[model samples]
Target: MDGPPATPPAPKAPTLGNALHRFANPGRFMRLSGALLPWLAAAGLALSVTGLAWGLVFAPRDWQQGDTVRIMFIHVPAAWMAMGGYVGLAVASFIGLVWRHPLADIAAREIAPVGAVFTAICLITGSLWGKPMWGTWWVWDARLTSVLVLFFLYVGHIALSNAFDDPERAARPAAILALIGAVNLPIIKFSVDWWNTLHQPASVTRLGAPGIHVDILQPLLVTGLGFLFVFAALALLRTRTGILERRARALMAARAAEPAATPSAVAV
Candidate 1:
């Protein structure tokens, strides 16, 4: 009698948790990031320069806003990165809290200051654009207010993360704050629709069609992508630095703990 064919081994399911776990090793992250860093940095710089030149010099002026509209090249991208950075921060924090990923805490810590700078750029540029268009340097508009709050949240996270005497103890509370602060992201996105404000409603991101003309929209998209690459490069660099710093600190602690050698033993 022919025996029944043996069953094949079941394939494992791929999930977010599993993927995160696979990349949790700090050494693996360092090697991968190191290999990719130069390429990412070069791409980022090239794109940024190309996009800025195209937008500032070549793109047609807006019918209504004129050259001041050119500010969007930097302002829009900074705003996008500011929000995107926080999302990354929150995700890193979540991974750190749940899986105890070795690099997650380092990622969260490094992302905060960079995100804060982007947020500040967004606000400053928004104000610069506003003064001419809105006839005011500032307003308590919903979108503006929420973005300001987001900036403060970034600042708070940075301060809190560095406040503790022990690096190991610093991450948890900041992570919790990050998770809680995520509520504001959606608010910032929807504020124009949710409330009447001085800020314009979505032109590029709306459903049906992007209200922006292709001439302007193309450059905007390019610049925005460049900013994204810049963010990635910066984050990877900072995370690598953080990893090296931790290793150095561990080495110092190990050396400090060793017993002092006797003078007689040294002479012998």
Candidate 2:
């Protein structure tokens, strides 16, 4: 007989990949999102109202831009979300392409339209602010041009994602497009520094001290948080809708494929 039994190996630690894999189950995600939806909606609405009111009414006016600077409350958050949304989309696309996660594919598809809307909002608000400050409705600046390309990429992704009758066939091409489009993101972020541009350089995110004053920065941060919450809530809603729609379609297809009963069987 052996003197002692062999020791067992230690269990492996959980990782990000394993955590993400847990959400691959549509039922689990639906349950989780349903539970969180109300809280997300309430927080998003409350924070947005508070932030907008604080920034628009209570914050001190900018010395240079005056009241027009208040546009920052909306424009800055929209721009941030536009960029952030694409990042989320690209990550989802990568997951879907590599792991073939159905939820990831749904996430990638659902995020495109939301990201496009945010990009549009950013452009419109920037134009509105520019008319007053820059004395023009639009400019072909590097930052602006890159962002415009981003918007177009979003539109293309949405179209490509839905082009095929079979969604499984659709997912791969859209994921590839999303990955290719991700190149524009870094260009959009660094456009101001890499080349001359009409757009202002970084204010809050710079390496040295922030260029903006505390009074303005506080509301900006708050508003940004509110926008982020809103995006999260909307994304969750869309993803859940997608999952339900897919399930419904699958059920319908299953019913359609069943063989019809013979006349004798029906009569009996």
Candidate 3:
């Protein structure tokens, strides 16, 4: 008889990459996010508070717009994040479509609503500022119209993503839409120059210098950073909530499938 076949060596213990694989599963993700939630919340709160106080109180008023310019603290940051978030979602959607990472679809799904909300806030706040500054509540200008299209794109993304019962099926078409809409981003940025619109020329970046003075720049930076932190915190929290919800549903289904074994198992 031949000698007993030798067993293969056990695989090396899993690393962080493996942990990430496991984390992609909803249950493990929920645990990790639960642990991280408090820290994220604290950071968001601190950043928002500091930014608001410094921006509203300490930052010098603009020479051109004066007190009316204060709205920039909210409007500019929201506008930036609105565009930034779509780019992020589109990237995540691409990953989901190509690599099929489990968390990628979840990310894409959650980010749409957040992006839409920010876009809406930007539009509203911008309108409020524009009415006084531009002498109109709304204009059919290129910048404004492109931003409107962006808002509608966000709405379409969120609605389409949830329209299907099968998560995998929903992900595929939604991912395609996100990728396509990403093309609109550069269009939005250049629309002001492409057409003579009411929106002002780029003040933050032009030629070799920023037009805004240091005093205004300082609070703008603070508010921008604060908005970034808040975005991160919200995204994390929303993704975690989605993971937990899916896990809980799966657990409930699993429990339902498990038989009771007639009360005798309980008696024993």
Q: Rate the local accuracy (lDDT) of all candidates.
A: 0.93, 0.92, 0.83
What is the per-residue lDDT of model 1 for residues 32-115, given as tens digits with 9 covering 90 to 100? 999999998888888888888999999999999999999999999999999999999999999988887768998999999999
Ranking by lDDT: 1, 2, 3
- Best lDDT among the predictions, by candidate number: 1
Arranged by TM-score with the best first, the candidates are 1, 2, 3
lDDT of 3 by residue, 19-53 (tens): 65665766666677778878877776787677777
Counting clashing residue pairs in each candidate, in order, gives 0, 0, 0
lDDT of 2 by residue, 3-60 (tens): 7887899887987677788856888898889999888888888888888899899999
Query: Please, what is the TM-score per model?
Result: 0.93, 0.93, 0.84
In angstroms, how far off is 143's CA in candidate 1? 0.4
